[model samples]
Target: MESRFLGIAELTDVPDVAVVVDVMRAYTVAAWAFARGAERVVLAESLEDALALKARRPDWLTLKDGPPAPGFDLVNSPALLRGTHLAGRTVVQKTTAGTVGALAVKDASLVLCASFVVAGATAGLLRERACERVTFVVTGGGGRAEEDLACAEYIARRAGGGAVDAGPYLRRADASRSAAELRQGVREGSTPEDVALCLEPDRFPFAMVAGAEDSLMVLRRVAPVDPPPSA
Candidate 1:
């Protein structure tokens, strides 16, 4: 197996498997939503697209970050999602980084979303598949997002047959500018719990996999046959 890391701009270069990382909040939020029992998540390129999808499917919930939008049902905060009941419901998600990066990968046989919370599981799934070529897409700021880049490297290392300690990578992610933004968001009414939640490596036992369905990118959880030993 061969694995490499790429930025959002290089998503088109993704090969057999594409792993999109957005550790600060986007992919973390998606993992939490799935953990909370969401049936599926639809990746939207923008808030307008999310709202349009919601309008077409009134029962689907729309989630996004930033200022409250007219049709959004929820904010893209894992802390907020923790209290909501999403069991058996479909979610339409739009974010500045994660969702866009996820939807941009056009030719991969498999697409996965990753964060510290699901890093080990994502890598485990890739190993199980015996993928020949894998690319980790750092979705935040076209790879300038340090947290996402660190998470991508961590996953790539693991997928490439390395049993490494996650401590250093987690520390790097915590010290990133995105982490600082998350802290600032907490002071502005977002929950502090999000900071802690986003940094918990391998918190989930399943990987989030995305499959193209018509015009939507649908994400579902897939547990690896053999989970990797704790990092």
Candidate 2:
């Protein structure tokens, strides 16, 4: 069977072994955070809210984060996580889009995170594992989008053992309009390019696990099956 199709906006859906796509940035940012040696991350939609969480935590908590721009230390760029630059840093990043989406799915079943970088891993995890169902939730601008929904459809197709279909989402399952309507108004920035990296299959081994906090998720770095070429 196809398991089931769910589209919730929060992490409580993790039990469904949900696939959360912040294709615009949050999911992408989470990818960069883990790539940069961030042991953990507290996702926040608003910078004000993210900083407030940091205020309560002790100094032992190393922190780093930023905007969606490339110059910022924590912009949603996976390229930013390259080399030995972030050997021992734990980040607490804030993005206008992806973080907010993560905040929305705080109660999901497994809360596996994705971007262009970990797409293959996401699909493999979904297919090889046994679960009740899987939800494909994309945050920012309802649900329809150029990249997010395309990303979602790509994933859903992979999980369901269907053919690889890269066409845009449609209004009706049979409509000509490409792409779902929920992905409208997605944020525009370097986030898209970052998303491209997330689209690549099995490039890295990292997944986001939601913590008890409202806007935070634990980033666990999985052991690489093969040597990553000079990331």
Candidate 3:
């Protein structure tokens, strides 16, 4: 049972478990939404797919990149979800690299989204499930970013039962090119506040599990518990 770290481009070789990380905003926001009481999250690879899902189920919350749409309740910014009531709600998340990486792991038996918010919990879940081969996929800024790589390293360490000093990695990530994208003018709908939220480590206490139920991909929270053995 060894856990390996990989980049977004090398997603062909899936492992027993694929842990996708998008620290800049996508997975961080998802973690926050779950902590705030979101029932389930649906990850969509494209904005069109999210829109189609939203059209069919008008009650589900849809989040994506760019400026806030007319009907969409929120964007991919973690700072915007504060104080919102998400209980009993389903959120459809469509991001550039995060959700796309998640959807690309066709060979993985289990898929989970990871961020600093849920790093420890994810590691615990993997141990509980006894997944021997795990791959930490850093979906870095559509190419490769320091933040995602740093997050992957931290997660790998935690999952391997090792104590990790994440300060240096987080500092590097804060100064990385991807962190700059969170600045107000760097990308549309991106805000400086998001950068602050994404860097906060261990902010949540649950791991996010992505599973297919009734042919629909869904994200659900995995609390700290002894999980059953891998299927």
Q: Model 2: how far is 228 from its true place, Å?
A: 18
Q: Model 1 TM-score? A: 0.94
lDDT of 1 at 101: 83
Q: How much is the lDDT of residue 187 in candidate 1?
A: 32
Q: Tens digit of lDDT per residue, candidate 2, span 44-80?
A: 5566655565567533132233434322334445544
- What ranges in model 3 sit over 4 Å off? 226-231
What is the Cα-based lDDT of residue 152 in candidate 1? 87
Model 2 CA deviation exceeding 4 Å by range: 1-15, 56-73, 80-84, 161-199, 213-216, 222-231
lDDT of each: 0.84, 0.51, 0.80
Candidate 3 lDDT by residue in tens digits, 1-231: 587777778766657789998998789989988977899999886788888889999999998877898767788888878668899899999888888878877457989898877777887788778778888888875546788888877777666665667687689789988778677458676778888888887777788999887667788998868322211
The alpha-carbon deviation from the true structure for residue 103 of candidate 2, after best TM-score superposition, in angstroms, is 2.4
Candidate 2, overall lDDT? 0.51
Candidates sorted on lDDT, descending: 1, 3, 2
In the order shown, the candidates' Cα RMSDs to the true structure are 1.7, 6.9, 3.7
Candidate 1 stretches with Cα past 4 Å from truth are 12-14, 186-189
Residue 206 of candidate 1: its Cα lDDT? 92
